[model samples]
Target: MKRRDFLAGTAATGTVLASGLATQASAAEPLKVGFIYLGVPGDGGWTYEHEQARLKMVKHFGNKIETKVIQNVPEGADAERSITQLCLAGCKLIFTTSFGYMDPTINVAKKFPNVKFEMCTGYKDAPNVSNYGGRFYQGRAVIGNIAGHMTKTNKIGYIATFPIPEVVRGINSAFLYARKVNPKAEMKVVWVNTWFDPPKEADAAQALIDSGVDVLMQHTDSTAAMAKAKDAGILAFGQDSDMMQYAPKPRISSIMDNWAPYYIQRAQDVMDGKWTAKDSWLGIDTGIVQVGEISSAVPAAVKADAMALHDRIKAGTEHVFTGPLNKQDGSAWLKAGETASDGALLGMNFYVEGMTGKLPS
Candidate 1:
């Protein structure tokens, strides 16, 4: 069911009761599961993927579980209230699917020790709270290679959502791979500061196109940039979802986050009373970070090379953050043959060498 419809129906019927209470009336009642979404599933990006996984999970356990979702829940105090409502409404497991919900998830988990909480793209945990994210840089390297080989103007545009480590890591990974394949390729980044704002994303894409960028990439969660790139007759990559409707012209490829396996496993764990607080950061190697099909617009040779890189990364034969690399100031980071550690990547704050402009403070 669509989140909006479910919410409206629940509000109209006023049936927000705890599961434990329902179980008293009928011991066969299904376990109550809940989700907090930063945006509606219709956004067709981040939340859409989560919503798909949620449906898959529900189907996997059919009559064994029931789900309640609250859409468009912002971070901070509002997130806390939404989470608390889920707990009060009898959700045995709750997934807070956004980085900004880290603190709020942790805070609410403290009050509901019996409830299991999972935070996506966050770095915090409690006895009842666990964190999980994808190593999307692996997929970024592949798309970056495509961008490098395809950009006629040698300028690639990136629509960024925020200056957080996740976004920064994507930019660095994409730029490094792009430069590796095409020495003349330069990345031009524009921060829109919001994840799901289509208008802002479109503006950023237009600005980049006006500045001579022929290839567009985005870390934001909308098709706005792709639409803008299409209108300008430029090549682009999709984010989070397949978004193949504009393929063969603008969207030559895409990076997808496959959350089904992880979601199913966590739900099963909760059902078996084996759920634990642990961190899971999966990548292309585990099928969590996936590369969508390369469109026919890409030259056969370029597509082959991109897929070869993808296989190498998945096989652990290549590391995206290998050095000799430097920070934006030309200071040495990883020496030749040395690779980046998870610690460094998680706290990455500076731009890599060859990148222009300051990272937002």
Candidate 2:
């Protein structure tokens, strides 16, 4: 089996327990695993994904990984206090799941080097703390392709949150592929400036619909966008969680991340005393970044093309950043047939060639 396949299979089986039983650990040691969440775990989107991960870790580790999550913690000082409380309560492993937790995570890592820390969607790292994210830009390609084939107006609306690299990359990815199949496609983006504000996110979606955009997509975490799309009778994609129920007919598909495996593995590593500080970016091939169940809203023909693109990406035959592509300003990004380098994909700053809207300043 390929290395990726091996990782997936092992992750599936919950393997990789520690060697050398000198530590004399038990299934009942009550290893405290803490989670710092930016949004409510029951929000049914981004935070829901992480919470699902926490539950799965508990399942694999049984009573060994006692989990505690402090959700809806504000950034900055409030974040620091919440984290300190978790560590002080004897958390052996902690997962801070938000980009805004970057500084606080690093500071806490210094103070609790013995207590392993893992921050999701964060860039900073330390000896005992590591980072993990998925190639979500890859998933965006699927959404763009589906949108390109489905849109009747050839216009798309984006509900964005902040100008971070993660959100920016998704913007570029969807815009590029949408224009690929629909030459007249143009993206209109509105940054709500908050990650999980449902009313604001829904308002952004409504604004897009009012602008005559036939389709919508979001970087924000909420089912509100999907619900708005349904009420407005427009098409959109789901994020983090399968939100098809919200927009039964208008929802096309979603980008699902099965983070449970990673959470389980990391906590197990800390318990086994073999935890290392290496970053990992896993994707569809490894069952980390995933595509949600496609909805009936999409045409059958578009579904075939989307599935093919996914397979090619999984097989390493297609890279979304292939060039002769253009930035929003029409500057050539890559030569024809040239795939974008990993570095450029990681730090993607420009919108793809046919995008109409500017990245939020």
Each model's Cα RMSD = 6.9, 3.2
Tens-place lDDT digits, model 2, residues 1-361: 2324644665556644432332455534778989999999778889998988787677666656688889899889899889989999999888888888878988988998788888887777699888888888889888888888888998888888888878888888887788778888888889899988888887888889999988888888888888888888888888988786764477778888778768777876776678899888777777788877678767788899998988888888888788777777877788989988767776777776666666766
lDDT of 1 by residue, 1-361 (tens): 1233533443333223324335543556677999999999998889999999888777655567899999999988999999999999999999999999999999999999999999999987699988899999899999999999999899999998889999999999999999999999999999998998888888999999999999999988999999989999999998998898889779999999878778877876876579999999998987778898999999999999999999999999999999999999999999999999998998899889999888997
Please give the CA lDDT of all the candidate structures. 0.89, 0.81
How does model 2 fare in lDDT?
0.81
Residue 236, model 1: lDDT of 93
**How high is each candidate's TM-score?**
0.92, 0.92
| Lowest summed lDDT window (length 10), candidate 1 | 11-20
